[model samples]
Target: MANVLEPYLYLQEQHGFGQNKKSSAPGEEGSDGKRDGEESSDEDNQAPKEENDDNEDEDGKSGSSSSDDDSEDPELAKLLRENSESPSSSDNDEQPRSQPADTERKGKGRFIHQEYDSPAGNISILMIACWTMRFPVMYMDFVRLIEAYELPYLDSLRLLPPSLTLHLTKQNIQALSPHFAPTPMHMHRLTSRLAKLMFRSYNILTPECNAAPLLWRAVRGLQGNPTLYTLTKQLAHTLSLTLTIHYSLAPKLKKLKTRDPEHHKYDNAPPEVSLAATVIVVLKLVYGLDGRKRTPKDIHDPACALPNLSEYLIAIKELEERERKSKTSILSASSTSSALDMDNDMLDDYLDFCEKALLPRENRNIEHGVIRDYFPLTRHSSTPDEGVRSEVFEDSLPDAMSAVRIHENSSDLGPGNAYAIYHTQDVLGSLPEDYEKIVNRAATWAGVEEDYVCGVVERFERRLAGWWDKVRREKAETLGRVDDEVCRICIGQLIQHD
Candidate 1:
């Protein structure tokens, strides 16, 4: 339920906008219209040094912050104690790490400002109450599962925060200026890449594995992937750009004349469903291999069951054109007046702010280091007595990895080879010693070089994958047709399960 009228302004008797700011506003410069109080430094312009919360581990996942001194803030101290006691906070390096408290820190004398937040991320949680529980429920002891394959770092800076592009505010409208605009390339690269990967990697994340992707994908993209749902919703973002450069938004998508069928039932279909159908059209119109080309057959493809998408695509195209014309008319009217410069200036700022908030990479030049995407996976130095785990890249991971297990009774491969098979559970091959020290220790106990042991592990890994595949299928069948809302909560609990 969206508010028809947002940013409710205060009455004259109430706390007017900026009333909390000391004395008068900035524009009230000495009768002459100059910036007031500039000679005296205003603390508002000076950004306070905010402490970054991301403390990354060797596996590149955000770990507990080492800033554990309790005496500074009693409130924080109490929080730390509580978190330490929480079951979800894990000691295992590979398990889900404890999230730091989300306290908004401020410097001394800093004014209290309402930090911007979005509900799109929490929408899945909201639907929990509405669910009938008809969908299959997943069952897994997450604590054990994560301890086995620290999955928290699987996507890194791979999902965008919901945009405020459509929810423009009075202050944001002023951001239309060129000075406030963001780099076109920055906006496209960060938003596009993160969204696609978040969707395309569906079912690829592995067994009892991560709940993040499923939670995000479900109830997204009109009962499909989110690539289109989000993209279409933000189509208004193109209006934020300069008219001269708007061509860059979707240069490859040529305007095509699509005909409306007279008796099509899709014309009366749900707005969201119709909008989703149009995404494939735009994908096909794009001149590159980026989105590939989507077609009517795609809806009926075994991979996708969107039976009605073929008809609804027409509705989406009409909706897109209507929105464009309506928004463009509003802007054109503004451009004809004295407010033209101001409107353009505000759009620039809006784009810049929106980009910084949504992008997971290079945010504020990564100064606060809030996002933990590129933190290097730590490698350990090993002594002869304690064997070393092999060096591995966190980014490049194989599709199938062997799970670590030492079958004492089975003679399939010697204990050493079996131990090696067990360690390859994750794509990066179980993360290094935190990938598991027992693995390194076991190999040493087997009295062989890890290189030789690894050779044996590789030979049996393919055969072991078949066993893992069957396990995943049985689990999926047992928990048939999972409800999207349930997946989010389950994963949410798993994340908290330490």
Candidate 2:
């Protein structure tokens, strides 16, 4: 909750509001027009370095520094310096941080600074409690309701009970989908919240499975009012993006491999459904899709300028191509061995194809590494035979590739033929690997061939992780500063002091 409130101040700052003026007693503004000995704590809430906790001397204070008689403002500076001196100021500096530890709770999982924290808001505290659960009873109930009511329309009607309907409506639909009916503000909020809860629950609560699509239908029905169609489209597009990733990661042919196949069908873990949920949450948080677009549907419609569909598709393609190249070399190497070693090799080939066809090929810049998250399926798999596995992209191939191959293999060709083509020298029967091999060799005749395009993926992974962490930290810090200001205002309202 503190994390959420922190952003309010950021918005205010963005809108050009200066920090709040310090409040003082009636006579405090004195001859110099500055309050003497005013205590101003620095608001750098970056978590403190751990090493500073043990050394009192290095803590932000010079204990022996005494002020001259006329230096009335020195004490305030002293306090600031003292606070800065403390190594653990962020977490444990509220009071004497190095006092003998409270032993009774030490072995029972107690934190050191629990007693010195400032009072927190009751509402915010409740939100914290809710967030802590990750998936709570209410969320589970919602999921159960969604799963039970299977059809799209049926799930919509049943899921929005009267109590839940408090926030249900058509107007809120403007937030995510312009094609949706003009739902009541309340209904829209309820649907949006419910959708979010279900998505989180599906992804974080249960193992990846088929039950996801049922929930998606409920998501789709939220667009009943035609007015929310754009919201629906945006929602669907985002959802598809997410599903594309989920499908890419999920295990292939789960039904054939598992004993309890019924429990994990597409209905249970449909990539599309999960993706839709992902779309809903991301669009809501990052793009403010509903608020900005309102009733607009087109890219230039002015509610908000969304990325062109062409751009998104292009991004998807480029991501796939990188994945294909990364895995193609490995599959080619393995293909030369034997037919019995075909499953693994064929799986890799099919995945390579899916990555190629599904993702957009044009690359403006791959450095952004936005595609990594979606292409996590092709990450190098670690196996005992390091040589064979080393060549494979981090056993990270997406689950959807497996599903597509399974469907194709099961429906049309026998497993042997299916597996054969996947690893066979002939792809589509039109292009022979023998012909392509000579061409590839001829193309690269000038220089000795390098084995693997080493560390390209690893470099991208590192860059992506760093970028993500930076974004999260910066965003969180900005919001933290905002909340601090709000807290200062609240504290002022509660007390009357000089």
Error of 2 at 380 (Å): 19
Candidate 2: Cα lDDT at 479: 74
- Expressed as tens digits, the lDDT of each residue in 1-498 for candidate 2 is 999978767644322222322122234322123233453223211111122223423444423233322444678668967766746665565554554455545733343332112111121233224434432222222222222222121214333345765675774333222221211222223333334454567643222322233233323222111212334344333222222112323344335455644322222232322333333332222223221212222232222333322232343344434434443322332234343543664554544544433343442224433344455445346543664465443332312221111122233321111111112232344423332332223112111121111111122223334444554566557677545345334322222122
Best by lDDT: 2
Q: What's the true lDDT of residue 40 in model 1?
A: 32
- On the 0 to 100 scale, the lDDT of residue 344 in model 1 is 41
- For each candidate, the alpha-carbon lDDT, in order, equals 0.29, 0.32
Residue 282 in model 2: lDDT: 26
- Tens digit of lDDT per residue, candidate 1, span 1-498? 236334333221221223222222323432222234235333332311111222211223333334633325788667867766745444554242332222223422132221111111222222221122322111111212222222221122233343644565755434221121122223223323333343356522111212233233222322223433333233212211111111222223233345532222222221212222233222222211122223222121221222223333333334333323332222321223233433443343333433444455545463443233344222234442332122122111212222223333443322111222333334464333322232233232222334433433333333334433554455556677445444433323211211
| Alpha-carbon TM-score of each model against the true structure | 0.16, 0.15
lDDT of 2: 0.32
Please, what's the RMSD in Å of model 1? 37.2
